[model samples]
Target: MLEKVAWMNMLFDFYGVLLTERQKDFMDLYYCQNLSLGEIAGEFNVTRQAVYDTLKRAEQVLSQYEEKLGLVTKSTAERNKLATAAAMLEEYETVKSDGRVQQARKIIEEVLEM
Candidate 1:
């Protein structure tokens, strides 16, 4: 459940501007504000079923955008690559009594700029 919420938050951050105002509002309330479906519906003066349906649709749309755009996928890949490259650089730095530190640093810089 926490993992789903975390992914939704990431997806929302990436593609939320593409969502409608009402969709964004409900998502923000549900995810960010930590509201229950009934609470959200009450706040909006709607039925619990209506809130559930709206949030369900919103999740569907967000997932579809992620599938087509893949911004989150690309971003995660790049971040993982960068982290691995950084770790390699750190390891090399500790063992570089042979003046290879500068070379390793340059390659790490290139990875970061990617």
Candidate 2:
């Protein structure tokens, strides 16, 4: 579950970067396919330690880019806004009134714009 969360964050945070082919392949195998380091290494004909190091380096590069440009931070803030809007929608649903639902939908649209 933690790994899933990390991969989701990575996809959200670094999807715009121009990664090398090897880095893209490694990330896809590790995060999209949920492969273990050993499994990824075997697929690439590399040692497990090498695969681990590559992943670590890739993560560091992504982190550096995010820190410098704040893309990840903005994405996280947007995600939080959407989550809050969803909760508001749920609350409005329990009220069972068209006016309240419309107001909540408007709020959701504003949140989405953020």
Candidate 3:
């Protein structure tokens, strides 16, 4: 459940503007504010089932957007590559005279530009 919220948070951060206001509102209340479905249902004057259904649909829409655009996937991949480059840069900083250190620096610069 925690992992689900974490993924939802990431997906929301990436593609929330594509969602409907109500969908965004429900999600923000449920995920960001840590409200239960019952809480959301009561606040919106709806059944718990309705809140659940809306959240499920919103999740599906977010997934579809990620599948088609792949912005989140690309962002994660680039972030991982950048992390690796940063670690290498840290290692290279200890031995600046190595020729590979300069190459590492160039790669880091390129990734940062991206």
- In angstroms, how far off is 98's CA in candidate 1? 9.5
- Relative to the true structure, how large is the alpha-carbon lDDT of every model? 0.86, 0.73, 0.89
Taking the candidates one at a time, how many backbone clashes does each contain?
Answer: 0, 0, 0
TM-score of each: 0.82, 0.68, 0.83
lDDT (10s digit) by residue, model 3, range 2-109: 989998988998989889998999999998999999999999999999999999999999999999999988988988888788788877778777777777777877
- Residue 91's lDDT within candidate 1 is 81
> lDDT of model 1 at residue 76?
88
lDDT value for candidate 2? Answer: 0.73
Please give the lDDT score at residue 113 for candidate 1: 73
Off by over 4 Å in 1: 97-114
Worst 10 residues of 3 by lDDT: 95-104
lDDT for model 1 = 0.86
